[model samples]
Target: MRIPFIFIFCLLFSAGKAQEFAISNYDVLWNSQSKNSSESMPVGGGDIGLNVWVEDGDLLFYISRSGLFDENNTLLKVGRVRLRFPQNKLKEGFKQRLNLADGACHISGAQSGLQSDVRIWVDVHKAVIHIDIDHSKATNAQLFFEHWRFEDRATKKKENNQNSWKWAPQGDVKTYADEVGFENGSLYFYHQNKKQTVFDVVVKQQGLESIKDSLFNPLDGRIFGGFLYAKGFVNAGIEEGNYINTPFKAYELKTAKPSKRQQVLIALQTGQHLSPEKLKSETQKLALNSASSAKKDFKNNQRWWASFWNKSYIQIPKTADTTAYQVARNYNLYRYMLACNAYGDYPTKFNGGLFTFDPVFTDSTATFTPDFRNWGGGTHTAQNQRLVYWPMLKAGDADLMKPQFDFYQSILGNAEWRSKFYWGHNGASFTEQIENFGLPNPAEYGWKRPESYDKGMEYNAWLEYEWDTVLEFCQMILDARDYQNFDVKPYLPLIKSSLRFFDEHYQYLAKKRGSKALTADGKLVIYPGSAAETYKMTYNASSTVAALKTVLQNFLQLPNELLNADEKAQWQGMLTRIPEISYRDIDGKTTISPATVWERINNVETPQLYPVFPWKIFGLQKPGLDTAINTYKFDPDALRFRDSKGWKQDNIWAARLGLTDEAVKYTFAKLKNSERRFPAFWGPGFDWTPDHNWGGSGMIGLQEMLLQDVDDKILLFPAWPKDIDVRFKLHAPQQTVVEAEVKNGKANIINVWPESRRKDIIIK
Candidate 1:
């Protein structure tokens, strides 16, 4: 039936209108896509700035750059500044390589020799990427940007003779030119001021070339070549004859200095030039506009992050785990960037990030684009990397979440096209590198490994299912705007496409039990390849089951009033055909799915809990959940992905399954360990650079332990330690903000906001 549109309780803030939540340590050094590689650096780099607390809000018209250089090396800054006109056209989507097109401008998506079409039409200040497109009637083409440049080597050589999207590093071309230049150690500029007005970009990184290049890769010349708006400054500026081209009285800053972070910020402020008095006066007359733009952006951004804390923040109190707060805080920061980075292009995931930041080799943490290894590509991973941000949706950090969803949506057409070309169908099957198109780069050092079974994990087959979960999760998290009817319409087709893959591939078992169906082998068989996560070569692993279950649930949960009866029935049959999970007895009582029931086993086997926690197909309140929980409890080590010494997976599993004390103790120890970086970030693993997957996952796990709203019931501290006496808030599935306090083993003072009543709020 039709799901009625109802207002979430309109929570009026006590602050009257606005609240400020300032982030420290990160220096608010606000900064500001994708592509190219031998082996794609799994998740691209753009999300770092946004999710890592690098922006004033998620969007602005400027780019932010940061870097660190040792005394021996010459590079000091990571990258630097650029500018844009409007903020609305800044669409956020992730790409495979450096996306020079309206989407991601990378070199991979071409049938090339050298290149053409995407050419440099430079003036004195900088060169403009001239990808000619039909002009927009209302305004400047939606997206645009600028960034600080410090390119070590930006080549002038053209490799092929066709249209291309990639940028190679500076070759032996030593000198800088006015049209296309590389000056100082870290700077690369594209002079295109003739189309626009007064010069407004930065010369910061260009000031830091004195550092050594031992650690910096000579070829990673995807330097800060004026950070982009994806849509470069149009035909110089705004095209003539446009109706909305009424110049809004802009300020042209004349800086009589080189550059510093503070200087760039000041220039940006002056360039926008909204006088304080004017702003104050506007606050009175244009209060709504102010509230929606600057004021609202600042307020909501703070509120958005603050709500993340209000919902189950865990501190070690006076225990050994003193660093819990910091680890949790940074973990929050990482996820936040994942939500922010895709302003108008793709969410950055790879090691060489989205904005053309330099790729370097370092011990992690401060390594600019952390984990940059040559033969292995950098450890800036994928799949598991995506799981890090999935929870952000229900956490209600919608601003950060929107770009990621947009990134996925923008690539749908390409994905479908690939599905048709590769699978002879129109399903959305993402390649191993989600952003870059085509295939594996032969240039990637580790492209071929005859000795190892894992040849760089380029198998793109399992992604359709992952994208399936993405669509399902997004439908649950999408704002009213994502859906045209205020329902899940925009995402329905994506979900249907994912389901189509299974319908064609899976066959129902001949002998079945009642309404339950099985795979032809009696085990739920996910052929082609198992769900890509868990890394170990296990066939029909639990991640696959989880994905299948989610797709089925989406179909069932789809509002009938929105879908026709026939479509609904088609989903019902598919759901029934899904099989029961296979389990092997652990010890004597508990049972767990065999790591590789049909294939080879490696890595942690216990992540089978995937179906329970992230998947939610079956859990505590469900029939066999307790057994599943016990199975995890028996050998929690089964879930450990990167355990060194003193590893204990039980703590994580406990928190995940609502076992309070055990989980807390284990989580705190990691924070307490001397192995981690000082302020908090964890590391030294293969794909190091402070794996927030562990830290962030712990935050969600702790939330579940203390106050899990199992099955949307708003249960408070359901498994909290009896002595802790804690209280917290959480954002529920239906956007319900539920709060509760538990003292002396009693969870009371419970408050629940039904859909008709709740607006955006913290559960506690």
Candidate 2:
């Protein structure tokens, strides 16, 4: 029976108090000020991220914006802002808090009888950062915009990891300087990418120079940066200083007189222009408009954050296990970090996103500038990147998944061109280590190449023939439709092209080796493939087969209007040809195999259990559940390779299989507080500090523990401890939202959207 919309609204509100309790309890409060940038709190929205911290008596923050790639493809920080209240230096009573509800950072300190409060927030509707300062006593303030890139700096040795030329450079790779100046009572800075960038280098290296004009180069003529200003502030000359191991030049601004209240704004702009003067003019205009509408913008920012928090939440009450509660807290904290780039032009990077600090903090040997992260800026490691995006589905953050989708959309033309020029095929063949312009990383493409080798393949051992990771993104695009009613129209081309590559390419490979393109049974032979960078040189990789089968099955489910009869038949035919997942008898129990056969293992990933997690071929109430469980428990490689760090998904698989004990053990291990003061700055674990994939995998595992889908039924507490009291709201397929709670070993359905979905709910 259908419930009235009015009745549903009432039910939703009756359960609102529990959600309120959940979202409000996770705000991070620090009684003392931070000592360095490593202890900073993350605050951002739209496409900007700021690392805010206090040191000695000064308030400081690092400015970072998404898509700020330079000539070397480095995601450079704009600069650091240092603010000092000369007469009101912090001496006693210092507090810094991340107010999760409003998506803002609040910092306050006292000196003798005077006190100052500073609120830093980013505008969700605009690329503007606002800092409002109010003092109990009138005091003069000094602001310094410190930029380390006053002149070109050559990246040597391992420092090259920050760019696309990781471990190998064709020539001297230098991070060019930025233009900085004080003008019209404000400080403005910008980096205009030079005409020649790593994009040009990679194109020439990969033998794509013939189709160079067709390639999409994001670095060409790109300019990014902004200006900072405050009313009643005047230029106070420039200062030079050294911070950690880096030397910087600062443009100083001082208050005209003592003041009790002040407002400062930093407006950022990014675009491709032939003229630097035109770009600066536009940036200044953005700054002026931002100042005029500061009040309205602040209100709108708060409203957006309010809606974001209210969309979904998971709360383990105070009485729950201490470790589990901490995991829940860290979950929200890391989600805040992901939300910083909700509207970015590019996907949130798997390595660091925008909150990475000085490299020395992550590795003492890496004494490079703040721009340095272990992985190259524009290099997308699809294996790690998928982990970052998979959790967004259940969190109801499908809208935030656009940049990632559009990322593939933007690079589709180039991906297809590579297929046509190299293999004479029709489809997009995206590799695992891809550049922003949709080609293999120049270094990973290998400078030491054999003349007779195939031009299409990356000449590296681990990445050779590894092309199926793109299928995960294709699955995400399809799932967006089922989960959120998202219009998958724009992404249809990407999805079809990706599927076509596997269909046509495998046949091409088969014809080269044998008399037939298909096996005796007519299924395409997927030989010389890879199983998640492990089980290399495989025959019929189970990961590839499962991914293709699942994505194809989902693609055909779309309405007839989106897919024509011919297209449907074509996809349906391909679906029929996808081979069944191979299995092995492990310890006398049948379990899914990584592939039909493999020569050797190269990486630590457990792709045999991939079907249990991302592919969903086996798990829960589904057939072959015991077989999948046996693989996780009995496979020697899966046992030896199981981990909870940096892109590891053992916790996710444990939850998917409804193994509550193992799920709790691994999920707690993955989401536990890091050694850093801010708990979510997870690692330089196989990546970089604030490991986004680490946090993303943790989020996926936690959500999987609470809710799961088995056919049409919504299984609640599938892997959750019955004794743990919790309240949560998460997304489900068919445009549904499940809101429920558990208290004292009893499950209660607080509300379910559409009312019809309530019948689908099953407490495990």
Candidate 3:
């Protein structure tokens, strides 16, 4: 796996410039085998992911796909696979590498003059896994389909965190068994959910049982699994074994005769069906069809990967401060992880996103299955989840944003039902922590609540009245229309309903307080509100004010056909009722305030500077720039809470304010190599292993530093260091793309799409 000195020399000289490197230069290479699953590399495409590694002279991997939640709402792995060569061991001359440019894994080794090479890749457009092997001499092969959920297992205290019933189960919770066996000369496995699921439990807990029939139950009768087959392999029978802390039953397959070349295919299927026999028949058909078209599928997958890499990129050469170079390399690595779920039925989770390993590696003293992640699987924390999708716009991955938007659109009815049944209002009330079925997470909703408390509100301290986070996602939908010329007409209902929640619900609360629906000056009162889980019991929280004003303005600016006269007038009226962002004098300089007034501080979050980021109301070359900058420099709370950790945006705010030194210090620190063997496998920081929000926040900061589109003007190197040479291609608003590079302290604009936009480029 080590690059030869001659090859390195030729690469640099042939390219003619260090800044003009290809994506393959950043491919991960390892010369030794992994000790455990924690050291595995991620290889996946479309919605399928595999954690691949070579351990103890054998090849191993764990399979995972999107939307595989079980009855308890736990995100489950499909199963595990193990491959072994009887005559040749992989201990000598071993090499394992991830080829980022091709979206494939290549592993090769030699033992006592016998050599072997294996290639593993997933089809980008189909739910199929391919493994191709070649050997110097004929060798016997063994394939094992290992599954831990072969029998029902009880889940005790602390283990319930993986499911929806966190810390409050109705009774004994058990992970049911999966059906696994050899069928028609293939290893088949699947998990079918029972009729009773967490969706039913949450409905009754939230007093929405009357509307149970109207809800969308994603886990009801759900079936997920696949078949592993090879032309020359036969069933070797089942065996029991223990790996790590769990016991498993593995269905084995072996080669019928020694062969120099072999091909293995696995076809996965997931859907809701009542008859297991029917589902099995469909799965077999898919496997047979995939085998017939394997050659054409391989070519199409390669073409897809080639086009994906050509869309956009960022590359930097090694520098004196190695962290700067590491930052750029890790950026591409993390983006590849996000691309794994481009076509997922659900969005890539903010916690692990399809790349989690064993739990003991993330946290000790808590032994659980591979399905265990700290946060609940189906629950979506809007604050953390928004960070995961926001960077996709500037990276030119707008097509990848569809899954997230479609998630919200599918559940729009349930969200609006919450408003109508509880408050008789006319908008969607999406909470801070929501389930995939569009209800409050039962655990966060509190099993013990006072009889007089509002039925619609969560009784928890951190999440109550924190409904404004959904506006950030609504804004993203609109930004897609502006940035990529996306057809967002389908999402207008979701946007308008979310906007109406603030307008109608606040009026309802205002009437309950006294008389008039608005204040004397005619602005909606956003009282009893929380600001990003901080600044509790606030009045007119600055985050809410900024969100409402910005989203409403953007909503009104859409194309005429997308919004009729009545819809436009209704939103314009709501815009008039949005309060102005409040300000405070912190240590003599005026800075943005968390809220007009608040009762207590609950958590650590700098919502005061939210206007500087996400909202984009104040920043470089904009009004009140000094006030926003002063908030970062002088505000005691902002200073006390500054961090480059998970879901934190201080680096983004610094970039927007044009603070080059602070941007470099924090952005580089956030994007630097992780503690794990894989450089981009960052974090259990406030989340789980391979924490995606941590990588996402880092991506936003890096993109902001390189280029920014403000007021239809493209600014280059806005917060970037001048002397550090770098190359990047990023998207801009107005359907534009910018490609630029810097070498020896001078900047060059290589190409700008729609050449007429060249006049709008400004080199900072």
Per-residue lDDT tens digits for candidate 1, residues 1-764, read 12234422223331221122223322111112211111112111223231111121111222222221111111122222222213122222211222211111121111122111111111101111112222112222222122222123222333110001112221232112112222111112232112111000000111112321211221122222231222112223212121111112111222222211111111000002233334233323332232224323334434544443443222222232335444444443444334334342333332222222223212322222211221122111344445445445445444444444554555455455545443454456543323222122222212224454332234232222233344334443333222211345666666676566555433321122234335554444454344443334444556666666665765676566657889888877766656556677666765657444544333442456666656665554556767767666664445444342122234445655665566666655544332422222333233333444444454455556655545435555545665655444445555555555555555564444454423332233
Error of 3 at 163 (Å): 1.0
* Top-lDDT structure, candidate number: 2
| lDDT for position 37 in model 1 | 15
- Residue 200 of candidate 2: its Cα lDDT? 88
Runs in model 3 deviating more than 4 A are: 1-19
User: Model 3, range 420-527, lDDT digits (tens) per residue?
Assistant: 999998999999888988899998999999999999999999989999988988999888877777778889899999999999999999999988999999999998
TM-score comparison, 2 vs 3, better candidate: 2
For every model in order, what is the number of clashing pairs?
102, 0, 0
Candidate 2, poorest ten consecutive residues by summed lDDT: 1-10
Tens-place lDDT digits, model 2, residues 1-764: 13347644633564554434546699999988777899988999999999999998899999888899999898889899999998776657888889988899998888878899999999988888999999997888899999999999999999999989999988798999999988877888889998898998888888889889989999999998777878779999988999989999989999999999987889888888746676667777877888888888888988888778777888886667888788989998998899999999999999899899988989999999999998899999999999889888889888889899999999999999989999999999999899998999988999999999999999999999999999999999888777776678989999999999999999999999988999899898998899988899999999999999999998998898999999999999999889889999977999899999999999999999889889998989899999999998999999998889888899999999999999998988989888899999999788999899999999999999999998898999999988888888888887778888888899998778767899999998
lDDT of each: 0.35, 0.89, 0.88
Off by over 4 Å in 1: 1-9, 13-263, 266-344, 348-382, 431-433, 436-487, 506-525, 531-539, 635-652, 669-680, 725-727, 742-746, 755-764
lDDT of the structure predicted as candidate 3 = 0.88
What TM-score, to 2 decimals, does candidate 2 have? Answer: 0.98
What is the lDDT ranking, best to worst? 2, 3, 1
